[model samples]
Target: MKQNRNFIVGITAILIIMMLASGCVNKPSEQTEPTQITVSAASTLTESFEEIVEQFKIENPEIDVQLNLASSGALRMQIEAGAPIDVFASASQQHMNLLDEKEMIVKDSRTDFAQNSMVLIVPITSELEITSVDSLLNDSVKRFVISDPEISPAGTYSKQSLVESGLWNELEGKAVLAETVKQVLVYVERGEVDAGFVFMTDAKIAKKDTIKIISTIPTSTDISYPITVLESSEHKKESQMFVDFVTGQKGRSILESHGFTA
Candidate 1:
């Protein structure tokens, strides 16, 4: 009986040890779950931002970063409509201002993070001798692709450039507006349109052999990228960290590599 009791006790102890080992393996070393943040960034930052996010993830495995890329105006409206986003990175200060005016963002967290200039692009295969925005109005040019001014900051800037340069009224009929700058690039790359206006960064990616950079809009009409944390964010701390990361060395390098002025 004594021997049996000892064997039973040993078995029980072994089972208990195994259970503890399993618990240790299955349980998280930390008591709390890592924080996660959702970021709504401008479509212009897609490639560069993805690269930066990947680097950030390696360093901050504890924090999860969710990203949504779209037109700044659309993203702003989404936040206003109560989208569960933690951070907002806009292509223009105007959109960010609208969010600030409506109290949708944490005002103190807003900052201008990067800069970009507009460029006139044409398909590489096009024999059209287009050198500037003025050439876009030529009779032979059937269509001029640009982002939608109402939704896309690049479009708005491009329109503003045209209007400021006295081209909007003359070429109004020729204008082909796209929902996003990337879409405009697509139209130009596929030779769907004769020409288009996009950020220098986007032109760098979607337009290499398929498209050619004709000219850059004046620096006076440059757009500044602004970022802010949303007031409704449940992960404000992590969100701010993401914002900081984007504005910091890692983000700046990525932006620069993609042809953005940081």
Candidate 2:
């Protein structure tokens, strides 16, 4: 009976040890879940960031990235409203300045990553000889589309370019405002508008043979891009890493591939 008891106790202890080992192996841990960072970027960054995120994941297996694409102005409003955004990328200094002034972005974290030129695009089928900005004033040109200046940097830049060129007042009446630059591209690509203004990067990704670039609009201010970590971010380390990745050589190569100047 003593020998049997010893064997039974031995087996019990072995089983208990195995169970503990299994628990340790299969137990969930904080490290099991990848860290997630949310990036609120301008609509023009859609393709480039999407590509960068894919490569970013390969290099950063421990981190997951989420993208929120929209006008810089609209994104700033979301951050102002306490949205859990980890990073902010704007197409203009105006929006970033607003957030920086309000103490909403990380100090000294703002970095200019890319520059873009505004281009005028039209449906591929339209044979209109649009050689200049002044051509839009032709009576035959019925309507043009631009983003809402109140919310989109593209729209603001478009308006600025037109105003500086002495055309905003003449074009405003015929202008159909879009909610985003992508929307403006869509409208022109689908022939819903006579002409549309979008970043040169946008024109590169348009539906094949759907749109044609007319001219690059001249703005009084250089169209610069800036990115920064938001003050409300819970993942400051990850956000800073992302900003570094985007401004680094790898990121510049990707941006350049999308027609943006580094």
Candidate 3:
């Protein structure tokens, strides 16, 4: 009887171990659906954001990221039109404010990620001897390229800077308004404009050797880049994760490397 009882006890122990092993084997180790996150950022962020996005993918291989770069206003319009975007990074607070007013952004996810200074750039080897805002009036500086003030945050800031300096009204007709800041860089690179206004960050990535920074605008205007997760995001958790990464050390390093102030 004792031997039989012992045999039954040993058999029960083996069954229990087998059941536990089966449970472990059957349990899901990770989430099955890979989250997809889409981000709409200003064109100015194209280079740096692209680099950091690669790093983000390496860190979270299960998440897929898609980046859409354009003027902040244009992107906002798309988001308003119900385009599927998980995140937004605007060149200025005003654009963020517009989205927040419309409740397009996830509350408490917005952060002022970085700042940029306006810059006056000209073709690197241009013969024009322009030095200051006043010098832009020179006949040699025929075309002044700038982003369209109505749709680009950088353009609006540039316009405000000029108007505040009492130069906008004077330089209006000579100004060539491009659709985006990146377009302004294109005009400057191809010598389409004798001089152009663009963000310092843009001048760094888009036209470092092609153009020379004449001057960095005064910082009194406080141009900041704000990033946020969208309320309509299908992957809110992953969206916030990317936002945290950008505002954190890895993101800051990328921004700083590209001449942006983090």
The Cα local distance difference test for each model comes to 0.88, 0.92, 0.89
Q: Report the CA-based lDDT of candidate 1 relative to the real structure.
A: 0.88
Question: Which candidate ranks first by TM-score, i.e. highest?
Answer: 2
lDDT of 3 at 88: 96
Task: Kindly list the per-residue Cα lDDT of model 3 for residues 1-262, writing each as its tens digit.
Answer: 9999999999999988898888844655776776889999999999999998999999999898999999999998999999999999999788889989998899799999998889999988799898987889887777898899888988898888889888889899899999999999999998878999999888887645788889887645698999999999988999999999999999999999998899
Model 3 worst lDDT run, 10 consecutive residues = 24-33
Backbone clashes under 3 angstroms, per model:
0, 0, 0
Best by lDDT: 2
Instruction: Flag regions of model 2 displaced more than 4 Å.
Output: 3-31
lDDT of 1 by residue, 95-139 (tens): 888888888889989988888888998999999889988898778
- TM-score preference between candidates 1 and 3, better one: 1
TM-score of each predicted structure versus truth: 0.88, 0.91, 0.86
- TM-score head-to-head 2 vs 3, winner: 2
- For model 1, the superposed segments whose C-alpha errors exceed 4 Å read 1-32
Report residue 110 deviation for candidate 3 (angstroms). Answer: 0.7
